[model samples]
Target chain A: MIWGSILGITFVVALIILYEWPKLKQGSKKEKATVVVLTGAGWLLAVLLVFFPEMPGPTDVIKAIFQPLGRYMEK
Target chain B: MIEKGRISAFQMAIMMYLVVVGTGIIFIPGITAKYAKQDMWLSPILASLAGILAVCTAFQLHKLYPKQTLIEYSVNVIGKIPGKVLGLIFLFFYIRMNAGGIRIYADFVAGSFFTETPLIVIISTMILVCAFAVHGGIEVVGRTSQFFIPLYVLFLLIIIILLLPDLDFKNLFPVMGNGLMPSIKGAITPQSWFAEFLLTAFLLPFLKDVNKGRKWGLISVFAIMFTFVVTNLVILFLMGSITASFTYPLLTASRYISIADFLQHLESIVMAIWVAGTFVKFSVVYYAIVLSTAQLLGLSNYRPLVFPLGFLTMLFSIWGVANETESSSYNSTIFPFFSLVVQTLIPLLLLLVAFLRKKSGRRKPN
Candidate 1:
C-alpha cells in the first residue's frame, strides 16, 4: 500500500513538473526563482507527507499558537 | 498585472456567496445548535450584521484604492515597512486559512462517506482541482461559481423540502427561553464566516464595474444569511434539539429525506454539490493567496504559485490532527476566535487606519 501511494505521488509530481517546467523557463529570473523554490519546497513537503503521513503538519503548529489562548478563555 | 481577467459585479456576487457558504453550511447547523439550541436559525441573522460590516469595510478600502487590492494599497495607507509586513501577514493568513478549509472539507467527506479512503487522497484530489481553477484566474472562478450557484441551491432546497414531514416546527418553541446571550454567543462563530466577505477586497479590484460593488456585496451577504436561516430551520424542524448531537445536522437531515420510501438517501448528491461549493471556496481562497503573494513579491504572474501552493495546502490539511477528535475540537473551540481576529479584527484595524490617513491628508492642505 505504501509503495502504491508513493507511485501515485511520483506520477502526480511528474505531471505537475511537466505542466510547470515550460512556464518556469519562460518566466523572468525572479519569477523563475520564486516558482522553482516554492514548487520545490512544496513538492518536498508533499512527498515527505506521502511517505510519512504521521509527520506533524500545520495543525500542531497552530494548536501550539492558539491552544493556550483557548484554555485561557475557558478559565 | 498577473491577473488580467475581469468579471461582472453579478459574478462577483455569486463568487462571494459560494465562498461564504462553502464549508460553513455543513457543520454550522450542528455547532450553532450546541450553543443556541432551537434558536440556532437566529444566530445567522445576528451574524449577518457583522458580515455586512466586514463587506462594507472592505468595500470602503476598495473605494479608496480602486485599482489596488488590500495587499497593494495597504502600503499607501501605512508606511512602507508596516504595509509590506501587514501584506505578508495577510498572505500567510489566507494561505493558512485555505489549508484549514481544505482540512475541514477532507474531514467531512472522510467522516461521512469515504471511510476507507486515506485523507491525503481526498485532500490532494480536491487541491489539484482547486489549483487548476486558481491557475485559470479569478474570472474563471467567478464564471464557474455563477453557473453552479443556482443548481446547488435547487438541490439543497429540494432536500429541505423533502424532509418537511419529519420536521417538527414545535422544535422552535420556547424561542430564546434561555435568553439572548446564548444566541449572541452562537453568533460569534458565524460572524467569522460572515467576515470572510473581506475576501471581496481581492475581487473588488478586478470588478468590471467597481461602482456596483457595495450593492452586490450586501446582496451576497443577505443571500448567504438567508441560506443559513433556511438550512437551520430545516434542521430544527427535522431534528430539534437533537440537532446538537449530530456532527453534521445538515447531512443528517438530508439522510432523513424519504419521499414515498423510493426517493431516499440522496446524500451522495448533497456531497457532490458540497464538493463543488468547496471547489469554489478553495479556488477563491487559493486565488487570493496566490495573487497577494505574487503582488507582495512583485512577481509577474500568480499561476506559478498555484501548484506549489496546492502541495503545501494538502500538507497543511493533513498535518496537526492526531485524529478526528483534534480536528473537531479545533473547529468548534479555537476556530471562531482565530477567525474573528484574523478575518474581522485585522480588517477593522486597517479600515480605521485608512480613515485616519484620509483625515490627516485633508489636514495637510492647511
Candidate 2:
C-alpha cells in the first residue's frame, strides 16, 4: 500500500513536470531536456532516500563530531 | 538610493523581528535550560540589552550615511579595498547563517513530523522556495514577513495558552541558582541571534520613513525578547529540568499539549508555522548576502549571483558543523563574540570613521 502511494505520487509529479517544462523553457536554451531529466532523477533519489532509511551519512558525521558536547551536557 | 524598493519602517521592523526570532524560539529554550536551568527566561532580557547595543552601533552608522547601505557606506568609512573585504566577510556570514537555518528547519521537520522524508529534500525545497522569494526582491520579502509575523505571533500565543494548563509557575522560581554567570552565559547565544538586527542597516536606507526606523528597530527587539521569554517560561514550566535534553523544547511543548486527545499531536501544525517563519528568515538573510555581495563587487545586477550563491550556501550549511551538538555549542560558546565583532564593532568603527570624515568635509563627491 505504501509503495503504491509513493509510486502514484511520483507519476503525478512527473506529469506535472512534463506539462510545465516547455513553458519554463520558452525563453532559455540551456538544455531543457537535460534539466527535466536531472530534476526527475532528483525526485527519484528523494523517494529512495525516504524509503530506504540507510545508516545515516552526513547527519551521523555531524552527530559524531558533536558527541563530545552531548556527553558533556549529559554529565 | 541604488535600490528602487521602498518599505515602510513598520514593515522593515517586522521583517527584522521575524528574522531574529525565527529558529531561536524552537531550539533556544533547550540550550538555555541546559545551562541556566530555571533562570532561562532572564537570559533573553540580557540578550535584548546586548541586541540594543548592537542596534545602536548599526543606527549610528546609518545616521552617518542616511541613504546608503552598509555595503556602500563601508567603502566611504574604511577605504574601498578594506570596505569590500569587510563586505565580503559579512556576505559569507549571512550566507552560512541562512544555510544553517535551512538545515536546522529541515532537521526539525525530518525528526518530528516527516520522519520518512529525506533531509536534503526538505532542505532543498525550503531553500528553493526562499530563492524564489529572494528573486522578488526586498519589497516582496518585507511584505511576506508582515503577513507572517502576525500569524507567527498568534500561533505562539495559542501554544502558550494551550500549555497554560501544563505550566507550573513554580518551575521558574529559585532564579539564578548557579549565580548570574550561567544565565549570562546562556544569554550569549541569543545575543548573537539578536545582533542579527544589524542587517537592518541594509534595509533601513530603503525605508520610506527613515525617522521611524529607530522606533521600529526597538519594537522589533522587544518583540523578539518577549518571544524568547515566553518560549523559555513555557518550556521551563512544562518540561522542568528535562527541558535541556530535548533537541527542540518548543516542539516538545507543543507535543505535550493533549486537550481531550484531539489536540494531542499538534506538532505538525507547529512545524508548519515554524517553517513559515523560517522561510521569511532565510529569504531575508539570503537576500542581504546577495545584495551586499553585488554592492561590494560593483555589479550592475544581483540577480545572477542569487542561484549560485544559494547553491554555495546549501553546501556550506551542510559542511558548517559536524552535528546538532556542535551547532549548539558554537551557538552558545563562540557566536556571541562573533556577532559582537561583525555586527557591533565593525559598524561602530565605520560610524566613527564616517563622522570624522564628515567633520573634515570629505562627505561624498559632491
User: Judged by DockQ, which candidate is best?
Assistant: 1
Stretches of model 2 off by over 4 angstroms after superposition: A1-75, B362-366
Candidate 2 chain A — worst ten consecutive residues by lDDT sum?
A: A27-36
Docking class of 2: incorrect
In angstroms, the error of model 1 at B43 is 1.0
Tell me which residue pairs clash in candidate 2: A62-B322, A62-B323
Query: Candidate 1: where is the Cα deviation over 4 Å?
Result: A1-11, A47-58, A72-75
Residue pairs in collision within model 1: B167-B237, B168-B237
True contacts kept of each: 0.58, 0.00
lDDT of 2 by residue, B1-366 (tens): 336888999998888887887877766777777778889999999989867876677777788888888889888888889988888778766766676677777777777778898666787678778878887889999999988987888888888899998788788778887799888767767877888888888898888998888888898899899989978888898988888788788887888899988877777778878888889999989889878876876755555445556655655565536556656665555455656667777777777778888877755566
Per-residue alpha-carbon lDDT of candidate 2 for residues A1-75, written as tens digits (9 for 90 to 100):
668747864774565466545555453444344334444544554455446545244434434655554444434
